[model samples]
Target: EITVKWAGSHPDNPLVKVILRPGMQMQYLTTHEPDDAQMECAIAAMQTVLAREEAEAARATDATEAIAAS
Candidate 1:
């Protein structure tokens, strides 16, 4: 199980942490910061991870099928 933590902070401000698990995706947006650009960035990051996982799953499935065929 791998954990990736993304932390964002403004100058002289406290850090905000977002934890992403190996097989989970997350999107975060805050009403306090209505124009929060971080939301899109976080979503993009999760999409990239999800895409990689999907590709890996497809490869594994193909390998399994090939093994069963043989």
Candidate 2:
């Protein structure tokens, strides 16, 4: 699920978007001030997604090789 909430008046609304997908591609951008913690969180999330994807790929490769050998 994806959600983008607007908080404020019509002319000044701060939008907040959230999506939970551990193994999905994602990109983060901002026009506001720089936040170190936010960047760290993004990096960590990306690492988790990449690791999961790699593991899944390895599993599929193993299964394919086994089937071929059989």
Name every residue pair that clashes in candidate 2. none
On residues 6-56, what C-alpha lDDT tens digit does candidate 2 reach at each position?
Answer: 221232433221232322234333246659999999999999999999999
Question: Which residue window of length 10 is worst by lDDT in model 1?
Answer: 1-10
Backbone clashes, candidate 2 = 0
Residue 53 displacement in candidate 1 (angstroms): 0.5
lDDT of each model, Cα atoms only?
Answer: 0.61, 0.62
| Superposition error at 36 for model 2 (Å) | 0.2
How well does candidate 2 score on lDDT at residue 62? 100
Candidate 1 per-residue C-alpha lDDT over 1-70 given as tens digits, one digit per residue, 9 for 90 to 100: 1222223233223332223322233333323463568888888899999999999999999999999999
lDDT, model 2: 0.62
- Tell me how far the alpha carbon of residue 65 in candidate 1 is from the true structure, in angstroms, after superposition: 0.3
TM-score of each: 0.50, 0.54
